[model samples]
Target: MTAPLSRRSLLGLVGAGAGAYLLGGCSGDDSSDDPDAPQTINWWHIQNTEPMLPVWAAMAEEYRGAHSNVTIEIQPLENEAFKAKLTTATQAGSPPDLFQSWGGGVLKQQLDAGLVKDLTDDVKPWVDGLLPASLQPYTIDGRIYGIPFDVGMVGFWYNKDLFSQAGITETPTTWAGVLDTVRKLKAAGTVPIALAGKDKWPVHNYWAYLAMRIGGLGALQQAAKDGNFDTPDFVAAGERLKELADLQPFQPGFLGAEYGSPDGQAAIMGNGGAAMELMGQWAPSMQASSSTSKKGIGDKLGFFTFPTVEGGKGNATDAFGGGNGFAVGKDAPAATIDFLKFLLTADNQRTSAKTGAVLPTVKEAVDAVTDANNKTVAETLASATGFQLYLDQAYPPAVGQQVNDSVAELVAGSKTPAQIVKDITQVAKSQ
Candidate 1:
């Protein structure tokens, strides 16, 4: 099977597929003439925990107060739960009026089924005010299908104190330097890294970054197109990952650690039990929530982009990450889109940024990022030369899941570098 359409190819197919449909067969009337007319918007988001949970509630309240005719029914669910619930709803031919979306393969599936609305015209007025890269994943076939609130990349979140203790003066810029840093940390009797092996996605990041560094962004796209990942470059990525794993750099019992649990990877770093972790922009907030003091490591933390591998084709500035956004259901009311627009205003985005929950997509609101670590991440993302969405979101579900599974096996030493690529190729071909 061929891979899912890339952002570029998908943009070419917009407007040629299906005509836009209004929610509940309602016309685009705002009901301003009839103040008594009621409009209810069903919203599903995965920010079930604080400080975002309350932040979202307040935003909705403010919107409702201004527009008495509109009532927003918000359902906040955990990340995995939201995915399962959304799947069931979409498959049943009913999705939330506006719900959380990552806007890649899954969004494409919904679009193919005519379950989501094309928001090109709805968001065009202010879409340009947001970072272009932040909109990449949401813009399909030259049409806007979602609106991004947060955008960031995956990188190393390290403890400055630990690095200083290890006697390292600078962050590593190459794979060899990374290994050397790990050795230094080990020599100083500290955990070099924190990993949540129980969550396969975190482990997959290492392999994904390695693949991009060794083979370049085109390599992944070409492999996906050809349904073959068992190439020399792919194997080399796995081998490089193995080299790191062989050093036994991760914290004790990392093979069984969870991602956001009390003793998970984030917690380890937050509690200062480990020196570093490779994670996305939300890492700091997660660390804070999971830490014993509920304050994380604070200013002790520093962000650095993923290092390059010598002889690699990828540039060091190439980013690998994704962000959160909202997808409007095909039958969503006109007011639903309006509420979405309200949520993305510079003022509202800045409000969200102040909570340290998001790296605002609106260019003007980026200055509201008060957390120093998050600011560094945002600036790095702003200057990135290239970007690749998370592999699980970039590819079809089957292929993405298989990538995670195979990479986890490689990390566990149950599969060889070559075998990992072979297994992934098998899954991709079957899809």
Candidate 2:
């Protein structure tokens, strides 16, 4: 599981800017290479945990076990460190054979660098049946470049026990209702929502959701693709986000909180002090790790899509997210593609889904989940009217950073809607 897409998306998007690269791999200096020497396929990922580390180990083991002639090496690093290393490796012309990446814009950067291989021929049948919206991010010039392993939507994950204690019976379904609910929750001595604004990424999610509610998915995507930040639609979205920020719905000093830490936010929600969390399916894993997991509070957690602004162009079901998946690198051995094809089969996806990792991208695997919570997430994703790729991935990197920074400043009362619009527009145009 990753940081909530809404907040983390922009950060991840603005993330891999030029940095000190870590260049370490097989020597390109080998003089007499046996043509039939087994290929070593390096798989890089940011799994800084025992639990996730084993998942990757299993993937590598299974892949290598089957291919016999191919050895898959797993390289795990801290998130930021991984990007820096990737930047270095690619520049050094000693990149990994395959690696983990978000399926859209992140992959596009590598694609442009001539670092990633076009997987269109191998993935066509699988890509063809994807949800209509899922196709756009992976398609660069009408060719597929990545396989989506986990695709899910972002939403409000709430503490139902807190809601019930506050006498609220149902999840709010519109923007007005969200405000009203937050007000009641705050007045009742519960934190209305948890926003880790210090991270900057969570703040980005607020802006993207605000924009989608005001302008709809198509409008937001259009602005992103055309690099038009000053459109009326974007301005309206900025204003709506500003309104949400002014409500002071987050815990005091939440603007100074570290987001990537699961314990901090989970503690607030699990204690029944926070009514809702604007997050993704990853919330479930956090819940599982909480003290409340045994007390039954974890089981009562509820989720709903971010509500649409009433009478706004967007539907309540419009969502924003991307699938995290594997991408084959340029010049990968034949066995590498075979390994990916095997691992991506419907059966393996179901196995991966059981880890509470994410909503599987394969339609059939998603249908096969028996867990109720996982199923709810699956159903919510499948039911979405459309999904906007996380804003960071939807736009250029610098533009994404400006949007993220604007939201953080706006929420802290250091900027206004007009100011944010101008700042983001300037960045977008410059990009």
Best by lDDT: 1
lDDT of 1 at 426: 91
Lowest summed lDDT over 10 consecutive residues: which window, candidate 1? 1-10
Model 2: runs farther than 4 Å from truth?
Answer: 1-36, 78-81, 88-94, 124-135, 270-273, 290-296
- Candidate 2's clash total is 3
Give every collision pair in model 2.
Answer: 6-205, 7-201, 7-202
TM-score of 1: 0.90
CA lDDT of every candidate: 0.80, 0.65
Q: Give per-model TM-scores.
A: 0.90, 0.85
**lDDT (Cα, tens digit) per residue for candidate 1, span 1-431:** 00001110110100111222222222234435354467777888766655677788888888878877777778776555566688899999999899888777778888988999999997888889988888888888888899988887788999999999999889999999999999999999999999878667788888989999999999988986888999999999999999999999999888898776789887899899999888887788878877899899898999888999999998889998878888999877767888888999999999989878688999999889998888888888878888888787777777877887898899999999999899999988986
lDDT of 2: 0.65
**What's the count of clashing pairs in each model shown?**
4, 3
Query: What lDDT score is found at residue 85 in candidate 2?
Result: 80
